[model samples]
Target: MQNDWEWFNNNPEIKKLMQHTATQGYYFILYYMYYVSSASSVYAGLAFGAPIMDMILPLNETREKIPSFPTNYGIDGEKYFILLGIHGFIVNAMAMAWLWTTDAFIIMMVYHCSSLFNIVGVLLQQLNMKNCNYDEQYEKKIITEAIIVHKYAIEFAEFIEKSVTKVYGFIFMVNMIMMSITGFYAVLNFEKRKSEAIRMALFTVSQGIHLFLNTIPSQCIINSSESVFHAVYNCKWDELSIKSKNLLNIMLTRSSRPYTLTAGKFYPVNFENFGNIIKTSLSYLTVLNSMQ
Candidate 1:
């Protein structure tokens, strides 16, 4: 067991990725883009993300840059502090990348599920409408191929999402609980030391904001997955199958929110309750639209 552990610990590829993501574990959290996250696996194996990016189009385009701690300083204490700071960022980057992979997979699975059910329903309905003697092999073949693609996509997406969600949830819970203890202590100490309370609040609030934003995509995935079944019941029989497939794909792939999380760069969140930051702006837009 010791030798096995030593082998893994010494492995270059294994050491390249983060073992876990913790708030106190690392010092800074990078705004990890989804595609960048999945590409980490590729990087860990092949040292590049180009080939993987060809297959996935992650909605997040915000490239968050982190300033690393300077390792060149001469003093031992300064070097130690710099090393610690840089380690935190390295851990944060790995965690953020995993979080992103989960988000992208969740979105893709939902789209495929939605398309699958709608196509299935349409095909079944068509089967019922056709005469027993009429030839339906070509139509059935096309529909079967489409359903296979969707089913596999949905399965693959959901599997990846669930695995990542569970891992992230555990990491998040640990961070919150640890911070909460610190926060409680800080609140008590607030009477004597205001700065400590402020510092604790900053960290706690940042975690809260990150967790809440993370949950949004998960909920959206659930909503998208259910939509697949909804498409089945609302089929139009007279439409050509290929044309219908294209329309259904578009409808299924589209998320309810036109402005993705990345759009927040334009709207800017300077408030509590992360969702409300977007909600307030959306409400204003609604009113503007009503006036127009």
Candidate 2:
């Protein structure tokens, strides 16, 4: 995997692609951090008797006191509140750090794997029949290099799938439950607690975004992998020698199968499954709402 990355970076074209990917990733992480920070601030404000927004007033009115300590504990003072607020802020920051690192790492790997497939596709598509006919050695070398890179890309994707299976599966389940509960609370409190309702709504949306982050990359992998087949097919393979044609056959066979990632080896992580998650969460929300 390390050598594969080194090879990817060594190519100027791949380096450019990686640079663009890195730029996009930078902005994505920035926006997500800002969003999570705002949410954390709002939550901290509500719990620590600090008002970050005027809309929080309605929510604060419902609370008898700041949740710094249990009433029976009798720890009631501005100093205690401040201390607890500081502690809570530190804890939230740590949690956000963990979330950002884990999710960002997974997203980065997915993007790279997708880019690898795309790179292979582009290389295959650039193959010229005239050049291949004139220079058999050149043809063989180019095809061999593409095959190796394609194989490495596939192996890298498999490694990622194995590593992230449990993590994505757990996240999938948690996000579904969070989306359902938050959606239910958002709707249930819409009239009486507008602020709380909005918070819950945001939580639901965040979960949706989280699920999208996982599924979209998996979809990209599928799309790029399939494109490899098209790339190989579109090339003028008929003019190549028998050995070269045989090599192309190998690529065609392998690229015919779209690469995929799964959650818990059960649900395929793709756009279709993403929609199903939303629908399933909504169904659960409806059931909860009915019970209420």
Candidate 3:
């Protein structure tokens, strides 16, 4: 009736005929939409990637071992591999828990894991930058070892990226398109369409972006395939005269392979815009949190 009065006051035609029923009529739509999008399978897809792996690699192999390793990074490559296996197992177990139940406990575990990953990833990234010796020493380490290290990383990144796009991306794309049409009806029926929380509306899209962003670093580090150098490093000590080591060093030091040996083996770590993208995302999340 108030809507009818408002109509009567504002527009002479329908003002007396009908009040705007839209606002009060269609409010439930938005609430339902929020619940469906934010709480469903969309969140699960993005959470599956491993953060501990990102931090584990450099910390264990580079920081933990050779002489005086830091508490954070692994001391030696062997310890690093072990930690990698353990972290990987934990992530897998969490995944298994999700398949069985969407229990709050499971979701919390995922959230905690992702947080830990983010923290460790950032620290490992900084630690790697500090450890100049890693590169210099890797320059001395066997080419075969270097190739395996690079392969393990690249395969891991590719697998995670592919899974994300294939699974979550598809689900949310349908959800978003459907919701958009629903939104159109919603706007048409309501006199004053209360804006759906923009942050909530874009929740599915954000997960897609998050997956792409997290995968970038792993992709970047794996783009090297120095294989001939692999053979040089694989040479038996008995087969290696000191002269051979000298020759091998010269060959490997100067030689490098583009990860796939194809023209476009893109490395996210090397990408000029990588760091800025991360900062921009964190900034956006901060702004959203403040708005809430």
**TM-score for each of the candidates:** 0.41, 0.83, 0.26
What C-alpha lDDT, on a 0 to 100 scale, does residue 205 get in candidate 1? 55
> What C-alpha lDDT do the candidate models reach, one value each?
0.44, 0.76, 0.36
In the predicted model 2, the residue pairs found to clash are none
Best-performing candidate as measured by lDDT:
2
lDDT of 2 by residue, 1-292 (tens): 3665587777787778766766666776676668667766665555554433334656635343344222333565544755666677777777877887887777778777877887887676556644534666777887898898799889988998898888889999999999999899899989987766776787688779878866766887798788889888987876677888899999999999998888998878999889989999999999999999
List of clashing residue pairs for candidate 1: 114-228
- lDDT score of residue 160 within candidate 2: 85
Residues 1-292, candidate 3, lDDT per residue (tens digit)? Answer: 2332442365343332222223321332343334444444333322222333346554444332211111344355454655644454455455534533432222222222222222222222222233445443443443334334334434543444443334333433444344444334333434443222322334534533433433332332332233334444454434344644564565455434433211123322223443444445445545544554
Q: In terms of TM-score, which candidate is stronger, 2 or 3?
A: 2
Better of 1 and 3 by TM-score: 1
Report the CA-based lDDT of candidate 2 relative to the real structure. Answer: 0.76
TM-score, candidate 2, is: 0.83
Per-residue error for 204 in candidate 3, Å, reads 9.3
